[model samples]
Target: MQQLLDHVAALKGEFDREVFTDSYWAIRDEYDLGAADEQFWPPVFQRAGIESDPTLVASAAAKDAELASTIAREPHQLLLEIADAGVPLGILSNAPHRMAQSVRESDWASVFAHLVFSSEHGLMKPDRAIYDLAASHFSDVEPSTIHFFDDRERNIVGAHAAGWHGHLWRSVDQARFELRSLGILTKR
Candidate 1:
């Protein structure tokens, strides 16, 4: 990611990692709340003592999308089996608009019944609003009947607070076991 940051810095002039990092952290929440590339990048560039060139902004957006696309590996085989078994699957992600776009364009997008991104909703995981919104996607399913798995403890805690079953994800085997214990997945 530093390499990408370096490339972004080179687009205008000398790069200061400290300035860039500070600038990015300052508006990280805004970016995750679905700010457009044009909206978010200019401030970072300006903060880094560089001109907010349109070309530079576009390049940064492209790099962000590219990086987000490669962040997740192929979907787990268990997820595929779950989907194949007629169970609904949904994605609730705290990601920027560019990341959302990349995921929507990926082949795995079809596997999910719903995809919710913080950028689109102005809320992020570990927040009750986001959990409530995600629960709504299930329509007829009651919150207690819903199950969620996340590697982040806070996110799982949020899920539980929202009245859904939450699992602290560790590995595929762990997730599979949890699902089976809940009777959500039974195949051996």
Candidate 2:
């Protein structure tokens, strides 16, 4: 990632990380709400004084997309176990289109009955609508019986507001313990 950034900096004469960060945050919600990677990267590059060359932007976007594939590995086995236990599983995430696509193509994708990406839904975490949207997929289950785990407190609060059981995710073990306590997972 740094290599890509460095290459952009070389081409543009100057690149400021803070500028890039600010630019990204400014449009992150829009990006997560289905904006194309092609749209997301140019502003970020321009803000950082990096040349917004299409190929460079694509390279950066591809690198960013790879993050979803790498980060979700820890929960793969646990998700598979839950699926094997006959529990319906879903993923609700605030992500750009590329990252969402990457996750859908991942090996663990099969374990989930639904993949709810804000990029496709136009609603991101902490939004009541997004929570409701996720819950809608589990129509047969009561809202309280739906368990949601998120690393962000605001998102957890939103889940709770939606009448679903929400757990703050600290680690895979913590999630397992919480799910077991909620009767969503049996002791193994």
Best by TM-score: 2
The lowest-lDDT stretch of 10 consecutive residues in candidate 2 is: 1-10
Stretches of model 2 off by over 4 angstroms after superposition: 1-14
Return the TM-score for candidate 1, rounded to 2 decimals: 0.79
60-114: candidate 2 lDDT, tens digit per residue: 7777777556656567778877888899998999999899999899877878888
What are the per-residue Cα lDDT tens digits for candidate 1 across 29-96?
Answer: 88888888889889988887878778988898888777766634433577787897788999898889
Q: How does model 2 score by TM-score? A: 0.87
Whole-model Cα lDDT of every candidate shown, in order: 0.83, 0.83
Cα lDDT for residue 50, model 1?
77
lDDT against true structure, model 1: 0.83
